[model samples]
Target: MTAFMEPFRIKSVEPIAFPTAAERRAALEAAGYNLFKIDADQITIDLLTDSGTGAMSAAQWSALLSGDESYAGARSFRRFESVVRDLTGFAEVLPVHQGRAAERLVLSALLKPGQASVSNTHFDTTRAHVELAGGKAVDLPAPDGGNIDLVRLRASFATEDVACVVLTVTNNGLGGKPVLMENIRATRAICDEFGVPLTLDAARFAENAYLITELEPEFTGHSPRKVAELMFRSADIIWASLKKDGIANIGGLVALNDPDLAARCRLELIAYEGFPTYGGLAGRDLDALAQGLLEVTEPSYLRYRAESARWFGEALRAVGMPVVEPVGLHAVYIDAGELLPGRNLPANALLAELYLEGGIRASELGTLAFGRVDPAGGPDIPSARELVRFCLPRRVYTRSHLEYVVEAAAAVVKRAEAIPGYRIVHQDPVMRHFTARLAPML
Candidate 1:
């Protein structure tokens, strides 16, 4: 079957609301320890996620949804084009449905058999598209900071049949760590030498930009807007997920400096989505996305998200669990390897435990980490492993929700320790799970 026609089996888990605050409180107390979960009460503090609900001004909202023909058709391309020019100053733009869709277009347009695209790390969907297009997905060695190792990446481009190099602004796979500015400049130099195009996966670009100015003291006084302009300098093509960075609905766009490349990508888009005018975005969502892009630059918007993440991180550490050393933009991770001692509980099991305990949703990074590869003359397919991810989507949550997560997580961890030897059963390598068999961990 073709890549798009592949069927995925669904595993549905029902969500149930906890009876009361007190009942949730009892669950944590019964667990005997409170370490490892986020404090719910602080989740919503400075919430500025693009999830449709962030506070946008009436004018901003109106500008987005006005559906007037001037802002809707071929003119709509200019709506996105103007936004890209105003925000990052890129020369050309093509709107798409969301980030991954942009990935599919870029990879399909540029990659060929025996070719490869390298990154420090990649979002799962991005890797899938590269491999699906008959190319290799190469990653730079992990840096000490869990960011990409630029030196190794520089070397990869020198030798490999590299079609393009993608650099995600904040390494989402690695706790949302921001890529250092120095690395961006170095990678750009390497790409310029090899005649390779550099594409940016900027799904969390705003958050990464916010971190550069706020968290990095050396970058103090630098604005997120400035940071975006600086980073885009290295990229020939920029792909952003409007849902994550813009007004939190579903839309994406690819901005490029080369007119020919942008035109080529647009041709492929027509078959999968629609015309250049409405590439899968509703009239209202396009408006929201434009407003959300502007909101990301606001100081108050950045403050709220950063503060909430910081507060959640602090509470997790106080309880004795290993949280990602420093918090990044949206989601957080609990090091399951550290949480369950001697049990060898894979991250997949921890994710399942979290789900069964309270209908809380999370990802099993290990099992879900997929990428395709071609060995000499064969087809590309996904790889497998086991790790868990807790994605804290912005705006939809409040502080109380975070506290509930932390408290409920603590209770589950306590219950896990009592099982003599609980382990994850590898039913499918692509998606692992916990079996009924339970024993004490030695």
Candidate 2:
């Protein structure tokens, strides 16, 4: 491979296919319905969780699993704190379990009835938590939902009920699109203007930082570390999933400048979770998280993941399948509309069909993206049945693995595209894609 070209290629490998439902059932039983079924020559490409396993050093693992919860547990806490400070340059850090846990805690501390949270964009969990707390989630008038709107956000801050502003890096709803840096700085100015705190939902922070500084070198003078610091500095509280940023199994951190708010979050942790020392994270997991955080900052590491997604996307596009243009590090979205007229199948059914094919996983925008939606009987938000998600877990699969997925997906889209009116069944009871029950016009 050339210096600029990655050695990875999905076409180089074979896709794993089960010959019968019984074998498929056993595979799901063993691995538990993860992306493991998407196999390569040697390993599976697991884009399911951002938490990268096997990244922790021996010393870090030893410290995390020691399990002696004293103020000296403060050392592990301090180690984590230093990591946050080194990467984000933030002054405070509070450990939490998973990304949504941090969101719930942060809002629990900050939200009140009638309070407003302004954001360039929001993940489903973030919006739900804010509304659950009786605070209104203002989607902050982005020029498009994919981009942030600072002028409208600043104006919203004029209200006394505005509690905080959130910015989700690499906006997940719009296929992981990111807000521009200038927009971020502008939002910071607006937050300052109204004295409202700006909190970053940094689940994808590592990837966003990498893209802004590296992939798009027009903004390269700033490293991921530098951009992270800039974003952190703008926030009163910054919270990110250790799963995504550190690449650990399940962990998150919430950092804030206010001592009072931090204390309040800790109190909630006591009631809901157990204690601050071990917030649903194994000590070994924390060590892994610490190690993963360091790995994500490397240019080569980010480039590897970015290139893999690009490679798969290219193959799909070459086959005439519509996909979200490559933007971030993780998943590639297969736009269903290109195959079916006006997304005729609906996301719910599309996800089901993809799973029934040799492939065992996927998602849709209208229903599965948020996982929760309360439709108003009146005029509705654009019911976009966007694309089927193919999330790639970091460091798990390789070139050959990527090819297998591309090949299988290409075949599936080709076959499924010909079928008409296959019903989308919502087994999860939460996010339903397309139901044969809903009229085609709906």
Candidate 3:
């Protein structure tokens, strides 16, 4: 393979502050050993998440100046809507402040008490919104749900009282794996059979499309944009996090062919967010998002976006770090269970040590994020996977940053056998990993 180069140059630079281990240790202790609680300034290489932490392109910045803020009739809104319509082919477009807000609006409009919703796997916010709307959210991952037969599973749901169905492209909480177009078409067919609407949490649509283009050999001739159009064909509605593959810092949108549902969400937007045009954001944000939708689908941009992630994941694996196979687009999931099977430690040991060793902050993407516990109140349910996620923000880090993380993993691996686990002393009932307090266990 030819040596990879970033598609763009760093026209500007922001100096990052590097904190000493002592500072990081105190910060971790004060923050209850939760990486989420660590302040931005304390983190040396912030891999905690890829959301809204990316660097924007010069074009995006230029679009910001072109923003025309006029309450309801903004030129920025027109451009944003036009871009979304062209990509999604959705007749109705309603802009929201972020992805979760789009999910909330859709769920609020479509779901009701005692209804059922299904996904391959629902992320925290998506599931919360479903339950908040009085629906029971169910996950039926192809293997995890006790059967590899998705047809049977779909049949089961169709026979029951199903309200809505959503498929998260590149399942976020589960190592950012992209869902195949075959699976998407199958899900859409099932939703159609039951007269249910199928929508997508398409936060990483462009990256997902790139994977489809690269890995699915039959699609070899298709560009990423064409692949996206193919994928969008199966959905009734599509909602996306502009923070992800949209190539922007912050924003999201809900677009669909159904005018009535779009009108209803617009009403919800007026009540909860702002006018349908702004959606609780400045017009400049819309301009950036519009430009992002266009840029993200460019073949060059998508190629670099994908190549960078594979490089990061491969670097870690090269040092014997057991990263998730076929590394996904946005992050690499270190298989902590495989790395330290003899140590009897949770993924946190790897997480904390990564910080203590190199000030590189990752996340516990497995049992911790999902709030799993053993049957008899022991350590988190020792499933087949225990992942420590290192997210790569788009265009934010250089190749050297990934090298630094690999070195940290190398140091952590050399001492993996002797490292002790940690016990969670305090946790919230929901999404506990974010605020949970931990103490060392030797």
Candidate 4:
């Protein structure tokens, strides 16, 4: 393999903080041990999320100046729409502030009370939106990787009123694993058999396509853009958080073929978000997103993106940390269960330790993020996997920064047994992990 190098040069730089361990400890305590609550300035490396945290390119910055600020029928929106239509082959496109907003609009329109929206695995926000719309969220993740359990999926359609089947490419909820193209085709066939609309939660679509080219021999010569187009074509509806693959700071979209469903979503958009064209964002954001969509499909950038995460994952594994196999494109997930065996809330414990070790903040995708509290006063049910995700932002950070992270993680691993478990003291009814307060268990 060729040596890994960043595809783009650093045209600008942002200085990062190096808070003392004592200061980080204080910050962690003050924030109730939740990484999301910590301030950005207090963090040296913020791996809390990749959503909308990436740096934009020089071309994207230039596009921002060309934005038309019209309230309706904006030229910027038209350009953005055209780019999306060309890429995804969807006729009706509606812009939104972010991915979750798109989810709210689409799911609210399509889902009836007690209806189900099935997926390989629903990310936290997507699941929340489904339930908020008075629909049940059912996850049917394959035992391996990020594909739906085809046998179980077929069975689900036979028994439940499935509103839609959503396939999250490079499934975020399952350690950012790539979904196989063959799996997608088989899923499409099953959805067709059941007359269910197949939706692609394609936030990381480009990364998924790129990985497909690498992993699937039949798709060896396909460009990332072509692979992405094929993947999009398989879905009847698509929603994306441009924050990920769009390479933009803020934007999302819903694209579909159904006119009636689009109309329903448009009504919701006008009432809640801005006009259908602009949604809740300024015309400048639309323009920037248009350019970002074009740039993101470049093979060079995708290759670098995939390899960087893989490199980091391999490095972490070398240091006695068990990382999720087949390291994903956007993040490297550490198996917190293996790292801190028998410790309650092991992923949460590792999250705190990483912060104190190097002022590095990361998200816990294990029990805290996905576990469910027993309503009948029994023990909490843990997530299928106890993992901590180190989500790398696009066009930000370098190999040197990653090396520093590896070193910091190694320090924590050396004394992993010393880490303590935690108990949640306060949490919201839904998506509790975002704001949950926790205390270390003695």
Candidate 5:
């Protein structure tokens, strides 16, 4: 196989430091063995998350120089809004601090008490926001990664007051799989029948569009941008974090054609985030976002991004690691429970094992992230899979780095059988993965 090369050249570098096993052990203990709590300085190969971790390109940095800092009508905001409009074909764009902020704003406008907001799967924050606002975030089961259970979607609309039907284009919570365009069209048709609005949690829409261009024969010859424009037609509103496929460090926006809905969202955006123009972001952020919007869907860049992810996932699988079958666009999820047998062994143990083996830090996605804890904070509901996720940041890390990660995985495999289960000592009811404290069960 030809080596997957990054399409861009590096302009600068940051030195990484490795910690000794003894030091890592101490760090893990200090962090309550929760990998999320471990300091980045001690992590040799930090793969905890892809959010805001990607290195900015030289052009993005250059665009920052021309940023207009005016509070009300920055030229940077105009460029950002215009670029987003051209790509999404939505008439209105309201910027926000990040994707969840956009989600919150849209939900605030669309949802009422006892209303239901449905999706393929709600990522951590989306669910929290929905529940916090006195609404339910209902996740419909999908048999195949691309196909949603239409029966479930219709059932959600039928049983309760359906506020909006949400489709996460590259479903984030469940292995980053792309939703098929046909399913999306079908969803829109269902929403139309129910008189409910259809929105997109489109953080990875560009990546999903690229997958459609590559996999679907109906769109065989389309570019990612064109595919994205076509896909946006299926949703009444689109929300995305600029951090993901946007290739920016921070920023998010909601795009919609509905005048009343857009006005409602903008009012909420100003009350919570900021002015519609900058939206709690600096003018430089808008400039970078404008540049990122243009660069993200370039056909060459999309192909390289997809191929590079496949290269990483395939490389690990080659070493006998049990990864999620069809590789996700941004991350590789290792089946930790399968990696280490015995129902007694827990998924959270993989974090400490991988860190100790090679100073590699990966996020625990299975039980530690999704498991529900009771009133006393012990695990009440166990999650289905035990997954350890390594999310690749865009325009960062190369084949060489991935090879090191594979070596880390190999090292974890050596002592996998010895790894033990864990119990959560303390956790928040919502989005507990980030702040949950766990201790290895003896």
Candidate 6:
């Protein structure tokens, strides 16, 4: 494998706190053993999330200076619009504060009561938003990879009132695996056969495109931008959290060709988010997002971004950790269930242990995140897999920082058998992992 270096140099820096072991223990207890509740000041190397935690480029900073701060019809919005339209080929582009807001706008407008929104795997927020709109969220993951089960998807239209089909490129909920281009084409064909609209949850579109150039022979030698355009061509709608691939600290967008649907979503946007142009974001944020969109598709940057995550995953797997195979661009997922066999709340247990081993905070993406509670007091349904995600923020953290993570993980593995399990003592009805309180099952 060829060694890839960071394509750009760091021009700014922030100090990280190195809390002592006792301080970490105190912080963990205070946070109720929830990594999300832990303060950033207590974390030495925060891998909790890749969302809105990236480092911006000098160009993005320069773009910020030129932002036209008008309440309506700002030049910043125009710049953002042009870039999105050029990339997505969508006539109607609606900006929002973030991806969930965009998901809320689109799902609210499209889903009727008792309808279903289907996907390969719906991320936590997307699933919640669907239910909030009085619709059901259905997932039909492929047996081998991140592709939607095409047979089940086609059959779903026959049996269920599917409002829309969402295809999350580089499926985040299922180990961040990239969906094959052929799968996208097949799904589009199926959607056309049933006359149902298809939406691409394109948060990591650039990373997915870069992987296509590497993995698919048909896309071999193609530029990431061209591959991205090809991927966008298959979708009737596209919504993205720009914080991931856009390399900006904040921003998101919803783009589609349907005029009536766009009009309906804009109404919701006005009622909830903001005006059509600004959409709950400042002019400076729009400008930064515009610049970041352009920068994200560069081949060198995408190469480094994908390879660094792969490097980290491979390193951990070499040390007896069961990492999710074929690491995705933004994160490396570990199979916590396998790591701590027969242990209750294995993912949550590993999460607490990681923080204690080193001030390294990561997110659990398994039972606590996706499992359902039995209202009748029966056994709680568990998620398909118990996973802990070490999400890498864009253009942040050096290789040395990752090395420290490896060392910490190695330590955990050395004493894996002694790591205690946990049980949730309190949790919210929806998205419980964010604020759930847990205790050790010693």
Give each model a TM-score.
Answer: 0.79, 0.81, 0.94, 0.99, 0.96, 0.99
Model 6 error, position 230 (Å): 1.2
User: lDDT of each prediction vs. the true structure?
Assistant: 0.64, 0.64, 0.82, 0.92, 0.84, 0.92
lDDT for model 3, on a 0 to 1 scale?
Answer: 0.82
| Error of model 5, residue 60, in angstroms | 0.6
TM-score, prediction 1: 0.79
Off by over 4 Å in 4: none
In angstroms, give how far residue 43 of model 4 lies from its true place.
0.3
What is the RMSD, in Å, between candidate 1 and the native fold over all Cα? 10.0
Q: 167-220 in candidate 1: lDDT tens per residue?
A: 887777666678767677778888898888888888888788888786567678
For candidate 4, the per-residue lDDT at 300 reads: 88
Better of 3 and 6 by TM-score: 6
Q: Per-residue error at 16 for model 2, in Å?
A: 7.3
Off by over 4 Å in 3: 143-149, 158-160, 342-345, 372-384
For 3-110, candidate 4 gives per-residue lDDT tens digits of: 989988888888999999899999999999998999999999988888999999999999999999999999999999999999999999999999999999889988
lDDT of 2 by residue, 29-114 (tens): 34323223334221233333344432333444555675444433645565666777787776656677788889999997889999
Off by over 4 Å in 2: 1-74, 141-146, 158-160, 215-218, 342-345, 371-385, 421-442
lDDT at 438, model 1: 22
lDDT (tens digit, per residue) of candidate 3 on 1-442:
7787888999988877689878988988888777888888888899987889888889999999999989997999999889888888888888888899999999999998988777877887887788789888777677522112366547657555778877888877667777887777777777777788988889999988887887678789799899998888789988888898777878898989888888889999999999998997789999998888888888887777678888888788888898776777788888887786754446887888898888889888656666555658776664345778898898999999889889988998888878787777897766677788887786
Residue 433 C-alpha lDDT in model 2: 30
Model 6: pairs clashing at backbone N, Cα or C within 3 Å: none
